[model samples]
Target: MSKQLDESEIQRLAAYDIAHVVHPQFHRADHDGAVIYESGSGAVLRDVRGNEYIDGLSSLWNVAVGHGRRELADAAAEQMAQLAFSNGYTGYANLPSIRLTERLLGIVYPNMSGVFYANSGSEANDFAIKAARYFWYTSGQPAKTKIISRGEAYHGSTMAATAITGMAPFHKGFGPEPPDFIQVPTCYPYRCQWCAAKPGCTLECADAIERAIVEAGADTVAAVIAEPVHGAGGVIPPDPGYWPRLRQICDRHDVLLIADEVITGFGRTGRWFALEHWDVQPDILTIAKAVTSAYVPLSAFIASERVHRAILEAPADAKFMIGCTNSAHPTACAVALRNLQILEDEGLVERARVMGDRLNAGLARLRESPHVGDVRGLGLMAAVEVVQDVATRAPFPPSAGIGPKLARAMRDRGVVTRVKGESILFAPPLVVTEEQADRMVDVTGDAIDAVTKGQA
Candidate 1:
């Protein structure tokens, strides 16, 4: 069942578009014609003009439960009618938020005890860093304000969050970023800088963290923040033994390890969290996206019992304080809780494991494709890099913008994807059946071939 938006509604949606109210992640001057997506159901979205497209990127790496699930809508409506907005500030408690905390922590890969709610992933990670710093500060580690992150990683966009991001593009204009943040090499095995002959390669990428901690003076480093499996920095999966070694390094240095699971949490990986893949536990965790399957804006940061005890030690006046007006909107929390239920009830986690294997198999067949320099991913998340030369692994000339062109071609063939740098990213909803996933790969491969002219 779909609700088709007529022409009049489309015009109405476009009328008040001064760009701020409509365009996002794009320059206002470049605001193109708005495609009003009217409604969606399992795996498909219908636009204002009635064109349908399969959600290839899961609506920005969320939407794990797909679209138009009646149960989600009903759950949101029920909670809204009962109680919609109440402050999460100063001992105020709400039903959906409370219930969701139980449900979320129930699945916490590391048995996190306390949770803090926020409206988006950026805010969650930003606040997580704050809490980490504050935890050490209150414990007499005043010098422990610096946070260490990885190169090419994206934690958030807020100042503290941006400071933690590993990508250079985000920091081009924002110089003199917070001094506490430092970056080591990201575990991008495909384009690994540490991948070379036996002379100097010993998976030193993980060893780089120990070097970073030592260089920063372990006494001053508060935490090490990283995505379990890097996203937005090019869906890079860690090499074997990477996470466990990182954990051991963090333990040796006494720095808290924060897993920014905003993108890989909630079954984006075959497991609930990518860290689970290595049986590693983190001191702090942050997640958004598929938490509510994009039905609502919700994000959370969870702290281990050890970190929670830091907050408990504070006096009443010294209680750690951080919140927003929409911190745990009941409707959103209700939807998130139900989203988890749908995942569990449907056994989609196991399904993701099986279908993810199928996705890789399809990509495995395309390894010889001229345009595909590398096909890499785990579970439902993966990427195919477009390169101009296989030997040097040089990306296509940025002037050609081949990635965007290929994406447009894929959309024309009824798939929507995104490009991070020169990498073509594919992260479909976990609900995507094997056939739908194959279409995802097929459409992407077809689009690449069409646009690149068999040129690698």
Candidate 2:
């Protein structure tokens, strides 16, 4: 049961938040006046006003096992009572973290042998970038330091991670990015740049990475980074041939491949890891978000045996040092361990596949909608791209704020979702039931109709 707050208490908290809390990636004015979401269970959240909403985006793409799992809470409690915190610095290790690492290795790709802990997906990627560069520098290839990412990629928000991030809006207000963080075209079949010159997608987007490496001199490129499915970049999954081609290109150039599995790992995409969809093996796989199901902030940087061996063989003085205070936090690891157990024990990964098929089929049926330009996604992570002219694929003006309007309509209809530019994306909890999915789809379609009636 959730604690019910009086109206005055809710108002007081809202006032305090407006005065002190600086929300990330949110409109301050709107957030200041927003409803206070107090608690959640299953796939539903309840605001202070007691209005219930479907956890449509899975609380920012986390919460895979859904809300309010007592087992996870108990796991955290036990770890906290035994040993709350431990420094994971050199020469220091905790039993929970060690066990967590062993368990993770048992589940990750066959070649991945080691894991580095961090507090969030951003830190994991930051560590990965440093590790990749350090691996080359110590191997006597100091010039191989550049990392090739793709446009529209969402790596992280840290300075180094932001530089590698392909979104322009995230870079705004920040000064010039660091050098050697280059970006190539992404595998977006709906809007492929190569399709203009060629009739169809030649997987030229995948070829672009090789072109970027060669153009920059492959000796100067350390690795190529990408998400198996571009999550925040509007849930854009790559072409079927993209990942294999990327592996081949990286092999040809001797550049490492980094899969930012922050959003797609841990069964969000039906598979334990999205790379399994294409049998592509990345040298380093960065994972977070659902690792602990957001019960606690935790992320893991899983490195392949090949990369681990090189790092291990480096000169003793050449240490690849990068970490956070909460890195390998014992409680976080314990929570994550239990979370993974729940995910596997309950067969949630397979659930994601079944529910995802249902969700996509529902969204695909909405193609009859005048404003729906594209419907694309894999597993439970999906999106419905809104447009002003579907025939021309002309996007609605950002000034119109159609996405937000549609989201508001859904909210009023008892659903929560994310609005990214012209796309309304969905990544509901893996435990979401068929009835809940039906409600989500029904509300979404009605919301689109109600909001875009005249415009469409």
Candidate 3:
């Protein structure tokens, strides 16, 4: 914790890490050794041992502009000197946060008037949930306290955010959950719960909400939250008509639609926001991660004018219901503003579109491989679903640890991929070149082939 250690020294320290570091979501029964990263640049990272690897997962779905961008570094440094820390609470304003809010709202469509800042995606989504409740309370609809979210969704780790998350395992042992949070089916066409295919299926998946509302009682539900493209929960992009139907359903039931744009925002989906691809906007949108390309910890919970007006018209005592110490940190906001400027001027969104198409096609060619079951994605976010047998869609036995094995094999070959459930996720920095995109596909193809063959 004193002077920075050399590689060998770091590895020794890493040895201690293995003995002590309890990484989240890891299978502690067999995981050994610390994975050490040294440094990085435009689309790649190197280990302490000097093994360079493509940053295929963009350091957990952030890193939009990629590593070692001096411009971002310089921006961070300058802001630090001028105003290291300032809270934008109680009508206080800082230049960076004020400017960042204006810039963010500009990219958003149909005009969002207010931006609520937080330190991370989890916190941002947490704020959105609280704000929804606060807005309804302010409007004299105190009974509208419940929130409905989709199964197989990822919001964040905060209690309120996690409460709305529909994934069951994330809630195991930690609950005693809050009242009024409910779950409904996800529009995952690949794993549709209602088996909604040609069999009155298109709207069936989305219509489950109608059932949920009927059961939960429409008056009790305040909002329904979803990721236009579910990121951590298997990168699920809803079916063709799924989102549009949800928009109509929410309108009919008087439930506010909250889009969790934490992962799909800022060109990751080839659009400014993934919902835009579906031409669906939400009453509230929560964003983080790529907002500043992960150069700083910052997030925004945006409100459409309807939601904005509801909050604005509230009596004076609502007290800015939710904000943290770092909510709109001046330095973080300054970096975010500059980051968007770069994304705009460089046309990175267009680049993500062209390169994503090329990579998805390249991956589709490998579907013949036994282990490749599904390749699905939009823009920079992609996933390869591995199965034991594609014909039956049989998963490897739970005892086999198939996902971690394949990921480690890919790592040995100098590419780092993220294994989520049965899928290997690929989300490189948006600045990745076409050749690098091909390399990402090629390396994973090789890894998949080897892992399946080895298991056989």
Candidate 4:
């Protein structure tokens, strides 16, 4: 067991964090009261104060094999002792990276021919954008430069990825929006403006992408990027027909489809990859987060055979001019190989499917509450949307601060997860037990009742 921090030490560290750490999505008020996590094992985390809480969001939806895995540590140490680092530049190569590439290609879409490594999802996505443009530039269609993304999408925080992200808040204070990035309507079934009143889905959301492609001129659009199941913006799973239609539209326009699977990849959504749920494939796929279970920083953008061939055939000068310093860090690759082995050997992908059903079933009972407007998810990923009025699906005003209130309430009850706007997202580790899954829903229900009891 690891040594525990004393009370004074904890307070000192918290103060240091407030003074130094520049957190992501930082808010000064929230940072002041931040809980200092010290250790985690399986689906539970222990704070410096030693209070345990269910890791409902898998620490930002990454730790798929769960926390405190000695196997991964051993793998990393073994690789580092053998060969810590290697230049993955053009001429040099490493064994672990090459082996991982082979393993990933075998499991990912059959069309994928190669992988380019990066350190984070943002970098992987930026590379995807660049690769898409490069493909068209070399194919005698230099004008194909624009990238279309859907509203409510969260690609990453990099400048190029930020422009591709459709959420308005991400663009605030970031100067004028970057050019050549277009936004279209999202396929959010609950809040879909196009078909909310209709008897059923008109799939007008998919048609909107087609409209955007035409409006931009097909020759100017290089690709259409999207998440298989939208995370962060909300746990909004696209309608069954949505992805297939989007794939058809991209093909019709000769636009490369880039699936940002940073959150949905590696068995988070039942299957090995969420796109497999729809039988649709993307030309370029950007993945991170669960790749190494966040053991170390690693990510990659994969290219389909068609896209790889185009870059390969390009002249030496135009030869996909992009590379990262840690392109294929051998240590990270070894850890990832071991992580993939654990995922496969333990059958966590199918386990996510099983536990996801249990989780959804538990959350389904929350529909009885007046504030619970929607419960939707795929596999182990789910969300409970709180509403001001159930009949109209009206959201609470921002000033009401319902999301933070509910988040605090759940945290106090030993259940911690993401509460974005009116959506309460739940994506526990695949190793979660039925009991832990039940606690997530039960605590959420109790929190909703406690927070919204007398509200009109």
Candidate 5:
């Protein structure tokens, strides 16, 4: 076991992190002075200073079963002892990986016939994009290679996945996005820019996709990729009719649908997969994060039989050969299997639904506050959109830095969360209790009031 570090030691470690660690998706200047987290268990995390905070974002929307699970650690140790380093690249298979694939299929939708392994959500999405392009190539429709994602969508960090990501910040300094990846409007109802977005108004957000499909021409489009709930893009759940309409549009246009379930998969949204809430099935599905509860890196790119048949059943000479060295790592698969078992045995999915209601209700009460514009989410995944005026729905100028202010206040109050622009995101571990959920909501409300007291 590791001993607690003294103040001097913690300062030294923070300095080292500043000098050596290149934190992803963070402002370099901020990370240079960021807090150094030491360890965590259950829904709480401790910084190097030994201050505990409720893990509101589940440490990047993973850790579904919570932190420091001994069963998962034991599973990893046992698998490592038995066979830690088999190369799936050379057609060598390991027991844990084999079992993980079987287990995933048994729990996932029936159409997901095969699983391709990777190391992260980004890798899974990258592979899914490649698989879609390869599927079209093998089907003798090479021109059908364009992928349609929504504006403000986030896929992953890799070049191919980055190309699919619709968030402008991720692509700002990156060179031109890869060819044939197009972005359409998102089905975000909270801040919908298209129309009034009230009852009886047309779902122009969904219609925008069909328009993009027509503009690209059906034959030129390969797939429509989306997250069930746009997590990184402000936790915006889709309009009720959005996903089913997208599914119908994809089918009508012969475009494959790819659900990027990295954030919403594995009971985050009160369902095994967020798409299940709408009963909408995608041709390709990518999963990560909660797969191993973030204990071990593991991701899966699952394909329907149609996609599988198109690629795997191709002639040997025409097969698309692609894989990573860490694909199907036995130890990671073992940890993930154990994590899934815990999620099932503990009934965390149903728990997420029940407790999530409490979380959302508590958050909804905050809309009575002056700065709160909206409270929205499904299950444990949710957000509170902060604005200058709830009546006018006017967002505070980025110059106000309300997001950063609220984040700091919430941290001071012993709660950790993610602030995306004007939206404060909440995705606590599925295992979080109702009391913890209430605490998280209370902290969020206090943060909002403390930050927006004068302005609001």
Candidate 6:
């Protein structure tokens, strides 16, 4: 273990961070209040001040196998010693990249035949967009350039990924919205305007995709991109029938289905991939995060055979020309390969299913609380929706500051998670034990009670 820093040294580091580092989702007002994490092991993290908290969000929906594994560190070091970087352009290749791709193809949808590497989820999704457009362009349907996304979807921060993202906050101050990106309703059963009142899912949200495609003129729509289980968007899993119908809709309209599995891939969900739960295969799939359990920066977009053939057949002048400098960094790929091995050997995926049941069951007890409007999740990923009035499902206004207050309460109670709007998101590592899972639930329930007590 590294030497533990004194309080003064920790404060000095925090001062340096405030001076130099610009974090993502940055809030100027809250910058100084940031928790400076120093070390982690399994589902627990310790701040610079030596306070430990249960990692309820898996350090941002990644780190499936957990943190501080010697094997992963050794993997990176071994690969770096031999070959740290390589040119992954069309003509050049690396062994780790080649082996990792082969392993991915064997595990992912059988129809997928090619993988394009990038450095992050945003870049992977951007490549997904390019691959979708390239397929249509080469197939003589150049007009089919529009991509449809769902509301509450969080793709990434890149320009194209931002345009494809459905959340307005991400788009705000991002300059002009890129053209040809269409937004449609998501399968959010909780606050769904169409079918929330119904006894069962009408799947009106899925049909909304069809409506958008029709409105855009199906011929002009290239692809419909979505997360199989919406992650950053409140951990909302679609209805069981959602993906099958979505597959049919995309097939009927000749629109490609791009599953952004950045957060749900690599055993974060019970299955290796979330769409696999529904037996639905997407035309293009983007995966990252737990591909290496966030030990290193690496991501890739896989293309189905049909899409691959289209790109392969492109004319010399109109070649599918897109590549990243660190496309398949040898060190990252090596680390990812070892990470995959760790996941399979330990059966972390099945653990997620079993532990997910335990976690959800614990959270279900909180439903009796008047403020908890809903409790929902799949596998180890879940959310608790807080509301002002359970009868009307009315949300607390922004001025109430319920999310921030609940977040602070949970942190104080030795749990750390994401509190978005009125929803508290939880995605602990797949390796989280039953005791840790129960502690998270208990802390969440107690935090809710403490934060919302006496609130009208």
- Best-matching candidate per lDDT: 4
As a TM-score, model 5 comes out at 0.97
The lDDT per prediction is 0.84, 0.89, 0.83, 0.93, 0.88, 0.92
For all predicted structures, in order, the TM-scores are: 0.94, 0.97, 0.95, 0.98, 0.97, 0.98
Alpha-carbon RMSD, each predicted model: 2.5, 1.7, 2.3, 1.4, 1.6, 1.5
Clashes of each: 2, 0, 0, 0, 0, 0
- Which is the winner by TM-score between candidate 3 and candidate 5? 5
Model 6 has an lDDT value of 0.92
Candidate with more favorable, higher TM-score: 4 or 5 = 4
Candidate 6 lDDT, tens digit per residue, 1-456?
226777778778888888789999887777877898889999999887778999999998888999899999999999999986877788889999999999999899989999988999999999999999989999999999999999999999999999988888998898887899999989999999998998989998999999999999999999999999999988999999999999999999999999999999987779999998999999999998999999999999999999999888878999788987999899999999999999999999999999999999999899999899999999999999999999999999889899988988899999999887989999999999889999999999899998898431
lDDT of 2 by residue, 236-282 (tens): 98878889999999999999999999999999999999999999889
For candidate 4, give the lDDT. 0.93
Off by over 4 Å in 3: 1-8, 19-22, 26-31, 196-201
| Minimal lDDT window, size 10, model 1 | 22-31
- lDDT (10s digit) by residue, model 4, range 341-447: 99999999999999999999999999999999999999999999999999999998899889998988999999989887879999999999999999999999999
Candidate order (TM-score): 4, 6, 5, 2, 3, 1
- Can you write out model 3's per-residue Cα lDDT over 24-46, one digit (the tens) per residue? 75555656654677688988887
Off by over 4 Å in 6: 1-4, 454-456
Instruction: Please give the distance, in angstroms, between residue 13's alpha carbon in candidate 6 and its true position after superposition.
Output: 2.1
Candidate 6: lDDT of 204?
A: 88
Candidate 5: tens digits of C-alpha lDDT, residues 1-456:
226677787778888877877789766676755867778999988877777889999999998998878899899899888886877874588888889999999888778988999999999998998899899999999899999899878888999889888878898888976899888878777677876457643678888899999999989999999998999988988877888998999999999999999999888888888888888889999999999999989998999999999866888788668889999999999999999999999999999999889999899999888889989999998999999988878999889888888888888898988888879999999888777899998888888898888422
